[model samples]
Target: MLSTSMRPLTAHLCLALAGGAFTCGARAQQDPDGTAVLDSVVVRSTKQERTLLQTAASIDLVDGQAVERQGLQSLADVAQQLPNVYFTDFTGSTPTLSLRGLGFSDDESDSLSTSVLIDGVPVYGNALGTLFDLDRIEVLRGPQSTLYGQNSMGGLVSLRTRDPGLQWGGSAQFDYGSGNRRRASAAFDMPLGERTGLRLSLGSEDADGHVDNRALGRSDTAGWSSRFARLKLLHTDGAGGEWRLGLHHARREGGNDFFVSTAQAHAHESAASDAGRSDTDYTLLTGEYQRALRGGQRLAITLGATEAHWNYWMPLSQYGGPSGFDSRTRQFSAEARLSSASAPVGGLDWMAGAYASRMDKSAPYLFEVPGYMRSETTARVRGATAAVFGELGWRLAERWRLAGALRLEQDRRRMDWASDQSGYFDSDGDGVPDTPYTSADRIDGLRVRDSEWLPRLTLEWTPAAEQFAWLTLARGYKASGFNLYAYTPSSAATPYAPEYGNHVEAGWRMRGAGNRWDLGATVFHTRLRDQQVVVIGAGGASLVSNAGRSHSEGVELNAALRPTAGLELRGCAGWVRAQYDDYVKGGEDFAGRQFPNTPRHSFGLALNWKPADGWETGVSVRRVGSSALYPDSTVTNAAYTLVDAHVSFRAGRWTLGLYGKNLGDAKYLVRALDARTVVAGAPRTLGVRASVDF
Candidate 1:
């Protein structure tokens, strides 16, 4: 458990920060001028297209240009810069997100509490695709359950890919970096006919491992390779309608890089002698249709299907044993909505929609102890959900607007699993299980269902053009599920209850200096009831349980400046005080303690320079504060900082870039065991890239 003694120190730091905030609020920073102005940013992540200044929720947009300059190859990299958000590890391919310090979970030890969308289509499980030919990514930092339904209590991420333009064009790029890393990407787009166009994109990366395996005397243990391919088609019938169809596939294969004990201070070393491997494959199909109406109304429809497979083997040198699993998931989803910026009735802006989805997950695995025993098991879980949602916005009075949204959903799940083989038991009660216990049986199946109603209300006041302030109240929800990792008869067959949260937030956004300067700040609090929490039970099994209640409060600030043309500055900071109001496990009460693996403070700063003659350069740095992991199962991580820099030359779509990251190769833990095993961050890396258009 995290020490309560640190609370006083944290409270003092927050007090000092509050004082500094008041001092800075007196003067608004200069907005980025020319093409770098931030107020003009438009996002469609909410299923409602709106300008940044007009939205009340917390959202951040990361464009492709910024992504390339920062060399952000994974979801974790982009998440680190956003306020009040963090990813669990650098565990390649798969990313686990925790937003607003809502880091509680009760299902898989590593499943996400949030939801991700690609082109308006919902995607579940590991997000393992390359971010090539991507247009932008919008991150909404509050509960999105009113629109996205379950699995989004934490937040939502929306990704948009570049579409096929009217004209024909193509581009390609190659990059080489430290650790013998190599990457290549290419894209081509062209008109197929009078009203049809198609686009294709592909990318691949291969690199040597960063961690050295001391037991095997090798540094090749954690090596990895990735490939991604996508095809999209666009059509316009010229009758106020448009359609898009897309197909995408991604594959990743790599050495397992979880963790091992290391003696070096700043270096990561593994003790595994076998150097096990992990492989993942993902495929998705998407279709979207939109039609414009006469009264500023529109009809939108989306359909999608996806499949993901994960295969891995772990040879824990410390355990003197090996474990492996093969798991797969298939899902299908559909959504339809009727929306209008100017409704015929009352002329109020509104949207109404229905969403439905189904998913199936299965896993087969084996666990073995060198010369002792082995446990083999099979697990299956199937689920379906249906929801109806709507949102409305109306002008209440002069310079005042009110918005409301509601969502009602029903979720159902069925669990059918069995196992063979068991372990020792404590029949003698001599401080240990002295008697042996064996089993070759199946447990009764389980069927569960849950329902929730999530709602939101927002009141906005625009005292002047280009400036607004708003207050919002919202609720978030997540569905119930059964534990699938157990081989014993403990908590596997039982279903956990759904979790819910009530959130209140207030914020203000302003853009001045002719839109060259942008600034914003927000204060939020969330009260979570029946929080689903997980614990590692005997034999490394995960058990799902509920916590009585918890609450989190935080403050966030963001600013962008273009004091002069060709120069831009950006920064963001967040501070959170999150703790359990009431929590009990195994007769142990842990109230008033911070949740594991949730950071208390995070900050970032960046500078982008664009001089004449097509020359560009930028520098960015970030600091992440300490947090505990695995409740009492792991130790806490200390605060750490990282820095990255890049420079590039561009002329008529041709560009050459150089980048360096983690300049100090900061010593920090990416993950840790409540006890000894620890995994450190990757060391410093330098790379160069070149690309062209035709």
Candidate 2:
């Protein structure tokens, strides 16, 4: 846990940093004839179009231009700029994501507490492959179950891709960095006809990673390569109707893990006996149709299908042989919605929608110990969900508005698992293998069903133009599931219960005159019941269980200032206290313990400067506070800070830039299983990039 005495100090330090940026901006001389105005940001995460200030939710927006300028390559990079958001990158099929201290931290590929959506469609498996050619990214904090449904018990990450334009144009970019890292991407947009257009995007990235493996005689133990392509076709009927179809495919191959024993001489050095590798392929297809209706109403429908396949082999023990896992997942989803127009009709605005989805997954697990033991497990799971949701907003007065939303959802899952093993056993309990045993076990037709009613209510007051305050109450839920890697019938037959949360938040946002400055603050609290947690079962197997009660409370602040022309400053800070309220496991009480993998304090500051017409420069700083790494242990990850900067110059249709990350070369842990083995963060990196437009 964070020291109580240090909490106030951390808050003060973050405030001081933000104040310094604001002070610098204020002191700069303003041009007599030119003035800077902040651009208005629009979001569609709510299934409705609204400005950031007008939306009654705790939200963060990252512009696509900022992504390009800062060289934000992955979701982890984007999380640096948002308050109360964290991403944990591991050498597994999926990374863990958390918002405001609530998240899924296990290796289960079918479950998510914070869901990711691409253009309003939920994406299963790895979402990292869809991070390019984006128009914008929106992070909606807190429960969004009323609109997003299950798996969104924490929040939602919405990535909107660029649309096909009517004009014919194209752009290409290339980047070269330290560790022999290389990246190339290109995009083209063209008009197919007077009312139709087509767009295509392609990208590839590869790098010789930083870790060194002595046993394998390899310097790129964690290196990886990936390629992706996307295509979209759009048509307008000129009668208030439109249609769009999209296809995306991505593939990745390489080493995924670099675990070094703490006894090793260097942090970036590993001594594993077996080389671990991972390969993945993902493909998605989507179709959308929208039509304007009479009486200020509109109808929209969306259909999506996705397939993902992943295979990996990793070393489980320091000296033992490697283990392998193979998974293939496919899902189909459809949704239809009818919404009132932007303009109010009869002092009311409303929306109603229905959603349905089906997913099928098959995963095979293998454990091998060269000459000692071997085990294999085959598992298959099928899940289906359906939901109906509606929201209504009513203006009580000229300055006050009230809104309510509700969603009824049902989820069902079925699993079939079988395991076979042959190994030496010590039946006499003399610490020696006296018997050779071969056994087979099967658990078939195991099923789980869950239903939940999620609701949200809000009250908003427009105290004045460009200023807003709101209070909200919401309920969140996560569906139940069985352990996919269970090696025994007992663990395979057990299913975890659904997790639920009640949340309350109050927030305020304001914009200065001419949009020269803006600030937003929010305070929130959430209480959870039946929190799902991973624990060590009999024989050292991992299992998911409905643990105990918990709560998370936090305060977040964000500010942006354009004190002078050609210079802008932005800062965000968050403080959270998340702890178990009543948790006991294996005859030990863990109540009041802080949640694992959740930071106590987070802060970020960024400044962008464009002194001349063809020149641009920017610098950003991020700080994360210390926290425990596991629920059953006191081991903690110390606080760390990182600095990144970039500078670029544009000449007509061509541009060149230089960027650096982790300039301080800080050594930190991205993941750790124990004191002996750990995964280290990236070292210092510098890169140059060039781009051309045609």
Candidate 3:
């Protein structure tokens, strides 16, 4: 697999080099821009926006130019090229992104370790990260729980979208790929008035799944389609007081596809051959205003509101006999923030803000046939936080710079549950008692309850011009909620305790002109308390509880070298040792068991060459290490590798591109566990795409 993955890369390099020589020879005759292109590269991995060489964090920033060049479809594909970043897609639709080894599963019952942000508005749902139109993606490793809050205890994925400037421009793209896949995307920025601008983006995609479903006489069951549209309006009074409003909407429809082995097919033959998939719709509106205070001070106020609705279908016949389950969830959130750029202390650039946020969630689960018994669940989260953050580039002893920050926050989460019928009702009126419904035995009736003070802090030190290093320590938390499906008459009504964590990290970075190369590495350890884990009994019932503590440590390396002016090479690799610290099972402590679904090793590399004659080409290769099932499963999947390539011809405002993804056609599982199993990463897909700018 590795050799095949490398072959396409080798071929692309030769083609790119040949193309570059011809283009360079012609370009030499033209005048060159004396201005340096330093701005083309960014350093968003860290909170501070410095050059890659100036920061100590191991971060990767994929800019809009790079995103366009690759014709990437989702965050998983984009993250695969970054060292220490791991991403997987169960279907072409859902992508799970993780930095270092701290992130792995996207279980609804588990807390998220990575926080995804869209245009500074943090998005926290399972669907938000799938949207593709973005200006840049910032992958910050280690604990960002302080600045980012909660799930960021592991890492963060912040996506910054394109801004509408003082120009009128727009771009549109269309593509038809293999397997009847069709896609279209377009965006425009125009002046609304004398001091106002408006920008809009729209995209739609549809494709057929690759897996074959013999029961349904179809070769595809994972097919999905999505549509997204967004609008932004900005107004500036030329006095540092600017107000902006943004509105966005998106929808997704899809199902899980897994090819079963011959052994599993003969046993009970329980599977969903014709079940509908999960569907979700998201809508949001946000506004922000900024103005100048006194004495070179600035102030900014931001307000946001969002609502998301999700509908999921579970084919119980696939699990047991013929049973069907459906769940609906509605979420609403609102937040306000006021920040100022003022420092009472000398040599400090400080920002202080008071923030409040509220979130409400409701979900109802019901049986499709027989006696429809409905169970309803709800949760409310309200929190207030006061934070003062400052980064001081203290120029001590010439080239040395020191930086540090502190954050303190408090959050309260409450959960409630109610039901019309116990858990199950005999709707069919059959004396045989259709299917044994969820038996509420030895369980406390569901009610409402609350939990409260999450806190965090960070510090960094850079020594001189040739070296940089930093150490960080922080705390993180995840609120607790009730599970309706896991509830019975004997179930406990009070919500479970929230998870907590203490994370520590240290790293080093070095870069210079010698080889015109940049390199960075980091090691981190985390101690988690009240870790949420699934508990099961002999009857195959499920419940969430504070199982046991765990520890994780990992090392990451990233390097980008410009061997020559026209050629650039980038490589990233990571290794992690994540395990249960004190987990007790079957009367013994399984302290060293590896975390389920967490890859031990992963790496990726990319090479891009720009030759003369408006031509460009690139190739990339990525590898994911093997992982095992949770709860002491003896089965483990082998590792897998993938390859991708791109070639484009550009002239003026028009460009034509050809791309091939998963070129080696490696067959591997992107996500797999009990409940719903998914297999086979997206197959090698080839397509031609065109883009025009005006």
TM-score of each: 0.91, 0.92, 0.81
Candidate 3 stretches with Cα past 4 Å from truth are 1-57, 68-71, 87-92, 103-106, 149-151, 262-272, 291-296, 315-317, 320-346, 367-404, 419-459, 462-467, 489-494, 585-589, 630-633, 675-678
Q: Which ten residues in a row have the lowest lDDT in candidate 1?
A: 6-15
Backbone clashes, candidate 1: 11
Tell me the lDDT of model 1 at 341. Answer: 63
1-694 per-residue lDDT for model 1 (tens digits): 1011100001001111111111112221223343455535566523365677777777766765556555667666666567776655434555655677664342252224567777777765354535667777777777785554334777877777778877798899888888777889889998998888999999898887587777788877787798999999999988868899999888888887545553542566676776776788888898989888776777888899988887777656535565667889888999888877643323477888889989888866677654455677777888898999888888767678788888888988887778787566667767664667677857656778888888989887888888889899999777887766666655666667787889999999887765567788999998988777765554445567777899888988987776777776777788888878988776667798887767788777777777766787777777878877543334667787777778889888889988887776877665554345655666787899898999
Off by over 4 Å in 1: 1-35, 39-41, 45-47, 103-112, 149-151, 262-265, 316-318, 343-347, 424-436, 538-540, 631-634
- Native-to-model Cα distance after best TM-score fit, residue 469 in candidate 1, in Å: 2.5
Best by lDDT: 2
Model 2 pairs in collision: none
Residues 428-452 of candidate 3: C-alpha lDDT, one tens digit per residue: 8775444545532333233333333
Model 2 whole-model lDDT (C-alpha atoms) = 0.72
Better of 1 and 3 by lDDT: 1
Mind sharing the TM-score for model 2?
0.92
